[model samples]
Structures are given as structure tokens and as C-alpha cells.
Target: MTLPTSDTRVETTVTEPGQRLLTVDGLTVSVGGLTLLDGVGLTIDAGETLGLIGETGSGKSLTSRAIIGLLPTAMDVTGSIVWRGQELLAASPAQRRRLRGTEISMIFQDPMSSLNPTMRIGRQVGEVLRRRGVPSVEVQRRVIEMLEHVGIPDPERRIGNYPHEFSGGMRQRAMIAMAMIAGPSLVLADEPTTALDVTVQARVLEMLRQVRAEQGSAMLFVSHDLRVISHVADRVSVMYAGSIMEQGPTVEVLRRPAHPYTKALVASVPAVRTRTAIADPLPGAPATPADRPTGCPFRTRCALAHDRCVEERPVLRIVGTDRLAACHVAEEVSR
Candidate 1:
């Protein structure tokens, strides 16, 4: 079936290049007196995609949840998350709720868990608009049109189907449709293609790119795979032990990493276009946020770790043109 070319709910606006859409500074999250995300900071420009890349428990997801005000009530969060000049942390629960789905939407990691099995696909997809008091007929029409745009076969028939009725890839596309239906300014996609196979992964990635291009929505794309980040993000922030180790243009950071951990990560990925040999796995286990060392958390596994690294924590600093690296020997590492 053909894709939907236009929808009344999906509005696109022209923005100045490099305009700031979201700014997150010194974001920290803690639970039970243990810090999970420490001094994390990130920025997303208008119509730009920023990738948050790191291992699974490195606080990447925590950062996104904080941005959308989804953290558990027990957790203590301290930081500033500004969206289009408004501070999100200071906003009341009612205000945050209003912005959550309409202005900022998130695509969760697992579609099976995310999409309610009991709910019909059409109802789930159109839930946001329905909650906003949109006419039921219009919501149904838009949901079907969105399902078609996301490449679901015969969306008119499939709209009445349940979550289990669709394949893993199709479920994800429905998730995308749900996120995009509101025409959100910022989309936080947390490993949106992790469950799919290689072929399906490629298709989902392409669809995401097309959707972003059409809607002009800025994205915070989080994934553990650097290769995936290379394909999707214009800029990337590499996390290690709840802190950003490196942040810069994706191509530059991948080409010549400015931190030892980043270097090791790059070396571990097998080159597809070249016959380059992949480096041996890193020596030590990844550091956890709660059990981190006194100085740099990555120093335990870093080959370049020195006496200075043990005594002092390195904060993120400008190491190159538009590049920020948190390393004691950043100058030497960049060379």
C-alpha cells in the first residue's frame, strides 16, 4: 500500500540552522543515596539528531527519562533540562504532563512491553490525540493514515488488530507512528530497533530517517552500537559510568577518539568496508555507577590511566574544534 503523503496533525516548520531545541546541563539522578547519572549534560539542536551511545547500564536511558520527566518518584534528580528556553525541572506535574506527549514523545526500547497487549492497535496509536479531545473519527482516520505511512500492510484492516497480531518490526513502526502522530518537537528514541534482526533493523532505521526529515523533529537517539550511531546521529555523546566521556561530531569522534575508553570502543567494532582487524576486548569489566572508583570511573579499565587519573576527576573540556572530552590526558590522546 502507498504511504500517507500528508496528515493535518503532522505539522512541519522551518527552523534556523544550529538553533537550540533542548539543553540539558549538569543532570544527575540518584536513588537510595547512590548516584546513577553524574553531572550528565547534552544539547540537541533544532531538526538535529543527537545520539547517546554507551553500554546498557551507563545511564543513557536515565538521561532520556530525565529529559521527558519520567523518572521514578523515589529518585532524586538535580539538574536543568531546558526545552526552547523553559526549565523542565521547575515545571509542575500538570505542566510536564501536558508537554510529555504533545511536545516531547519517547519511543521505548521494547515495543512488545511498551504497547499494551489488551488495547487495540488503533486505540493505542491514537491515544494521545484522543486524550487531547480530538474527534474520535478524526483520530481513527489519522491513526490509520499513520500506520500506512509507517509501512503497515493494509492498515485499514490491521488497525483493528491487537499488538500480538503484528510482527516485531511492525509493532515498532506502530510505536513510531504513535510518537510522530502528535508532531512532537523532540523525539527521544531509546534503542528503537534493538529487538529487530539486521534486515528489519535497516528498514526501521530508514523509516526513522524519513520521518525525521519530513517532520523536522529533533531526536535523542540512544543506542549501545557506535556503528548505528554513526549512521543516524549528526552528533554523539559517549557515556561511561554515568558520565559523558566524549561529545562531538559523530564522524570525528569515531574517526579519532579523544578518550581511551572511546578509542577502545572504536577498536572493538569490526570495519565493514575495510579489512581491518578488530582489537582484543577491553581487560576489565565495565564499571557500575554505584561501585565506581574515586577518580575517573573508566580509569580502572583504561590503559592510559596514570597517577593523575587516580587523584583527580577529569571534567569535560574542549579538546578540538566543537569537541568535548573528559580525560586527564586529552591533549595527548587527541594527537
Candidate 2:
């Protein structure tokens, strides 16, 4: 791996599918002495999907932003973010710019704000290709093909439409088209379906699944909805107070959570086939990184908290086969 630092630089290389695409280790982000993300680690293989699930302010979006180099200049970031074999933490602005849109793409939650209100959808989607020196005629053809692949109706007619002219779902499809136009190796989707209704949400999710299948691209899917994560993710990471509480195979972790926080989150999801009572809300306000406690970040809301939890922070450890949790009592409580 090439470790680029302030005084060193390296050339970027193309990575193939079925190989490690992104590796984040001990990623920490802070601004004005307030920590937003602490020691967060994640890995995504080419063509694999990793779901990041947490409540609002759990650092899920922050993690994605940090990876994509979208964080504010005031924020202090330290840690290793390796894409393919290149370290990104110390990479130059031009290096990151070269990677964005072509090697990596992001689909924001609100398409209305993310899409250019003044620009036509076709022009916006094809801009990346044109910037990379693709011929105008070929760019137009590829843009139309991508728009149709993402389920946009009447691509020929809608090509001239502006952001405001499309419906919520249609606008999101356009966003996906833009993100996929360059055939990025990694896609960061931060709650892309959160703003749509149930029917439209399902359709959009299906479209993403199809697109990933065809493109064979890795994805870091961030969302607060466990139901959505279950449908789309192969592995899942549970985040809280800027720390990862637990992570493992999606079905295994949900069925038998090892950490207290993961247990509470899984319990909160409603059952469909059987009649079940609503779970009681977790007591206390969600923890914030600015005022987080000394030890385990989830201890404030964890029923299993003890003196050990209060005095010493727990790092991620093996709780089961291919599973890891950051709780001292993980073995005792793991089901």
C-alpha cells in the first residue's frame, strides 16, 4: 500500500472487482475541539455492499463525508483512508478531485438540493464524461443510456427537463444516473431513499440493486432504517456516538445482537408477520460526541453498563465467527 503523507505523493492505480476497494482505519474527525467521529474503522471490497446504520447524529454521514473529502476545511481529520492502494488522508486537493465523480461518486439524501436547479438533467449527468474528454456525441448517447438504465421514462423527452420539472423519485433516478455515468468503483449512498414514500422507496432500492448488479461496484450504504439495511446490505455496521458498536453479517447480527446498543436497535424494529407490541423507547437522549462519556459511548443508555464499562473503553473484539463488538460484556450478553 502507498502511504501518502504531507511530504510524499503516489500515483493512483485501478483496482479490480473481488479485491479490497476501500479500507478505513482509526478514522477520527473533529472541529473546534468537538469530536464528530472517533476511531471509526470500515472496509469495503469491490462489488460488496456494507450498510452503515445508526440514528441521526451517530456519525454515519460524517464517516461518508470524510471518506469523500467533503468535510469542511476547519475540521481536523487523522487516520488512514486507503482507496485501492492509495492513502487519501494526506492526498492533495487535485488528487481527490481526480478521484471524485470518476473513481468515486456520492448520492445525497435530498436530490432537490443536490441537483442543479438551473441546469438541465441531461447536461448535468453528462458533465463528468465531458470533463474527462469524452466526445460530445458519445457523451449524449451514454447519458441517455444511463438515464434509461436508471428507469427514467421517455429519456429522449426528459433529457431537456430541469430539476424542478421532475417528481421526487424521478429526480433521485437522475441523481443515480449521474453517479453511475462515470462507472465509479465505489458509490457512497447516504440515505438515498429516505425522502421518498414507501412505494417509491422500494422502487428506488430495486433500481440500486439492479444497477450494482450490472456495474459490479462496491457501495457504502448509510441509513437509519434497519428494514432498508436488511434488504440491501450483505454486512452491517452499527454506529453510536461516533463509534462503531458492532458489525457482522446482516442477518446474523440482527437475529442475535452481541452488543447492548445493537440489541436495543434490533428490538426497536417492528415485526411484520406476527402481531408484536411496540418496543419502549430507549431512555436518555442519544449520546453526542462533544459530551460523550469516558468509557463506552453507549454505556449511558446501556442496561448492561457496569463499573468496567464506566472506567475503561472497549475496543472491538471477536464476539463470534466473523463478528466484532466493542463491549466488555459482549460474550456474556451475546445470544
**Backbone N/Cα/C clashes per model:** 0, 0
Cα lDDT computed for each candidate against the true fold? 0.86, 0.84
In candidate 1, the residue pairs with backbone N, CA or C atoms under 3 Å apart (3 or more residues apart, or in different chains) clash, namely none
- Model 2 local distance difference test score: 0.84
Q: In model 1, where is the ten-residue run with the lowest total lDDT?
A: 272-281
Q: Which candidate tops TM-score?
A: 1
Q: Which residue pairs collide, candidate 2?
A: none
lDDT of 2 by residue, 120-198 (tens): 9999988888888778887788778778766788998899999999998889888987877787778999998876778
Task: Give the TM-score (vs. native) of candidate 1.
Answer: 0.94
Report each candidate's C-alpha RMSD, comma-separated, in the order given: 2.1, 6.2
Model 1 stretches with alpha carbons more than 4 Å out: 1-7, 10-17, 272-279
Expressed as tens digits, the lDDT of each residue in 1-335 for candidate 1 is 33355555744345555779899999999999899999999999877899998877888988998999989999999989998889999999998998877888999888999899999999999999988888999999989888887778899999999999999888988898898888887899999887777876887788778756766678999998877898999999999889999999999998888999888877777661233775556678888856899888899998899998999999999999999999999878878
- TM-score of every model versus the real structure: 0.94, 0.92
